[model samples]
Target chain A: MRIVVLAGGIGGARFLRGLRQAAPDADITVIGNTGDDIHLFGLKVCPDLDTVMYTLGGGINEEQGWGRADETFHLKEELAAYGVGPEWFGLGDRDFATHIVRTQMITAGFPLSAVTEALCDRWKPGVRLLPMTDDRVETHVAVELGGERKVVHFQEYWVRLRASVPAEAVVPVGAEQAKPAPGVLEALAEADVILFPPSNPVVSVGTILAVPGIREAIADAGVPVVGLSPIVGDAPVRGMADKVLAAVGVESTATAVAEHYGSGLLDGWLVDTVDTDSVTRVKAAGILCRAVPLMMTDLDATAQMAREALTLAEEVRQA
Target chain B: MRIVVLAGGIGGARFLRGLRQAAPDADITVIGNTGDDIHLFGLKVCPDLDTVMYTLGGGINEEQGWGRADETFHLKEELAAYGVGPEWFGLGDRDFATHIVRTQMITAGFPLSAVTEALCDRWKPGVRLLPMTDDRVETHVAVELGGERKVVHFQEYWVRLRASVPAEAVVPVGAEQAKPAPGVLEALAEADVILFPPSNPVVSVGTILAVPGIREAIADAGVPVVGLSPIVGDAPVRGMADKVLAAVGVESTATAVAEHYGSGLLDGWLVDTVDTDSVTRVKAAGILCRAVPLMMTDLDATAQMAREALTLAEEVRQA
Candidate 1:
């Protein structure tokens, strides 16, 4: 089977690891969200793309589910000592090599998609990874800080501020003008199944979908489009997904999230067994719904979740 | 006393440390060579300037005479793993931080002179370090590689090739069009004594003098311009200075090096005790010459060399 996954950072990367294990024979193409990409110390940093690359390639910090294992923060410490900072973003020495390479390639006139492919050559992440759009698309969050409204880079909002203040708006700046990167539409068009792996709907998967033609291509791909909920029992299983979801006025519930994606783009939806009650409401909204164990507690548990999503996709195709 | 020094990498940095100790209360301004600067992994690596900064600030590796004392190569190893390299250059993690900061500032439109000053804020390297020129001035070495005469970067010749082949020509590529960096000429004009450290006469001090107005400024400054010879006993005290010195048709001897600077710019010259026989030969060329212990074996010994250079400057002033 040819599977296409729209991935974010930790959660999506972890889920993809499971997907890889569950469907070992399947060809997977990952469309990674570049909206979270930030230039730190004049190097391009694609958090989501690196997360997926590192996790799948066995370089990831398994405990944190992001960054490289056995990584040192000497580079970051030195940069801070030089008073160059966004000190909150934890970029390690090993992790910095990725950004340096990517930045060098990009500065040399290679598109981000080409740079991603080159980086993946080292990781051999198994799946082909393509950034959603090569053109810059940064996710910015509008928030009220010190009683004043300001728009901050998504990283500052998420990593630095820890999403402390309420997000008034979440904007994927430049998405409207960005064209889907090469091979993106073709991958979606030829995919047997498309999966959204419990990533932040507002800024992760949502940001990728915001790219001009990507959402339209997936909707028109004629494949079983299934999504696993990031929410379980009215709360995010990981990360502050609810905060950004609130910015888009989506309730922090599995059924609400499924309805937010809506029946037009989603053919199947998976909620955790904890939210089994929400299945009927999601099905009532004209999408096939199933309640399965959605927590990626370990590789096996996550693999089982991936298998469940595939099974649900088969059911949607048959329906 | 206001002292100005022309510096290169390791040798120049070590000599500056001695100078600092020798004249503890002297106002020192160092015009650092930038021709050895190169862009590696898309970051500006200013070897000479950084060497001076790290050496004086107590961050230098005492044994190697360059780079950070407790440096790690994790970033470099990772970069090599990605096959992104001219893998021979030894840039450590902490050293990489300086380049990254500099590259970022330069990208944001800061000139190298300003960037060097900002970097000094962290190192507190005592002297005011100014690059010879803000404009790009790369030293290119013409050599017969694989039996073909080709031009390669100065770093490639010195670091990668280790100056294995004879240097047919040493060209400071952009120097003819490059103007001295801000304050370079002013520093010379106000200098009480200008000293040339025992840096490479061909690439280090010579490259700095190649900047359009700097040599003229020093000569017209009318202050005592005294130089300590890098060559001793008909050979360079350190580094492969002979290879490049030959490219300019100057023999690698204390007398020849003094003649290379000439009496017009150099008022006094210091050679090692072993090269005492060359003092009369240098004096015949119309520049005052002296024989002193020129080895920088330790701090105290090196400080004595600095004191000797200052004493020669006083003698030249009296003459």
Candidate 2:
């Protein structure tokens, strides 16, 4: 089966690792969110893309779920010695070469899609990783600090501040006019099943959908569009998903997440067994809903979740 | 007293360490050659500038004499795993950060001189280090590979090829139109004495003079432009200096180097004791000449040579 997954960083990388185990023979194409991309120290760093690449390519730090394992901070110290560090985020020295190569290729007249393809040539993550768009579509969050509104990049809000404050608004800066990258719509159209892994709905899938023509292409893909709930028991599985979801006015609940994505794009929605009671409200809202074990504790558990998502997709296709 | 020195990589770095000890109170300015500068894995790497920075900042590896003292290679290994094994040149993980910051700052509307200043802010190298120019003046070498004229970047020729193959021509690509970076001329003009360290005459010092107005400023300084010989008894002090000088039509001799710079720029010249016989020959060319222990074997020895150069400068000033 050809499965297409739209993903964000840590959660997305972990889920894709599981998906690879679940369907080894299934051709997986991941449309990764580049909204969190930051140009740091003169290199283009796509956190989500790198996470997926490293996780699947077997270079990821399993504990940190980001950066390469056995990474060193030589570059960071050198940068610090040069007084060039805003060193909140853990940008390991080993991880920097990837960003540097990507940036170099991009600067040398290649679009990010081409540069990403060139980078993937070495990693060969067994899945085609396509960034949502080649253009710059940064995700920014507005917050009130000292009774004044201030906007910061997604990485600053996520990594540096650790998202401590409440966000007034979340904006994907260039998403309104940003066109989908070349392979995005084709992957969606040719996909047997499109899955939204337990990634941030607001930032991951929402950011992808916000890009012009991508959501419409998925909606008309004529394949089952299944979304697994990132929230269960009124809490996010991991990360600041709940905090960001709150900014977008979505309660950390399965039914609310479903209602937020709404009946427009989702064909099948997977809720955790803990949120089994909320399935009716989701189904009643004109969407096919299934309750399943969604915790990706290990590869087997995540594959099981992947199977559940695919099974729900089959059911929606039949209906 | 104001003093200027032309520099290269490790050997030059070590020599500068001695020069620092010798001229602790002199206002020293380094005319660092960027000919060996290369874009590696997408980062702008200036080997000589870094050598000067690390050495003067007390971060230089005493043993390696190039990178940080206690450096890690985790990033380099990772880059190798990605099959980017340009394994000839040593780019330690700690060192990559400097290049990244420099490249980043340079891309973000800052000239390399300003970036170098910003970088030196933390290193506090004490001596002023200036790049030859802000312009991209890449040095290329024409080599006969299988009887075909192939032009390769200086680093590839020097590091990868190790200058084993014969070089037909060495060209500094943009030097014809490149202006001296800000402060370069003023440093040359205000110098009480300018001493050329035991660096490669062709690639290192030659590239510095290639910048449009620098040679004239040094000639016009009117105090004295004295040089310590990189060549002692026909062989270079270190590296592939002899081969590169031969490529530029200069013989690997103390007299030939002084003759190469010629009567036009230099006022006084110092040769190794081994080349004492050539002092009279060098004097005939209108440059004040002296035979001394020009080889900087240790700090005390180098300090003696530096003092000798100053004494010669005074004698030349009287003449």
Which candidate has the top score in DockQ?
Answer: 1
**Candidate number achieving the greatest TM-score relative to the actual structure:** 1
lDDT, candidate 1, B217-278, per-residue tens = 99999899999999988888889999999999999999999999999999999999999899
For each candidate, what's the DockQ? 0.85, 0.71
Return the clash pairs for model 1, or none: none
CAPRI docking class of candidate 2: medium
Local accuracy by lDDT, each model: 0.94, 0.86
User: Lowest-lDDT window of 10 residues in candidate 1 chain A?
Assistant: A36-45
Error of 1 at B61 (Å): 1.1
Please, what are the lDDT tens digits per residue for candidate 2 over residues A1-319?
A: 9999999988888888888888899999999999999877767899999999999888899998899898777778667766666788788887987876787678789988888888889888999999999999999999877888899998999888788998778999999988888899999999999999999998888898899998898889999989999998889988888878989999999899999988888988999999999999999988999899989888899988888888888999899
**Candidates in order, interface RMSD in Å:** 0.7, 1.6
How far off is residue B256 in model 1, in Å? 1.8
How well does candidate 2 reproduce the true complex, by DockQ?
Answer: 0.71
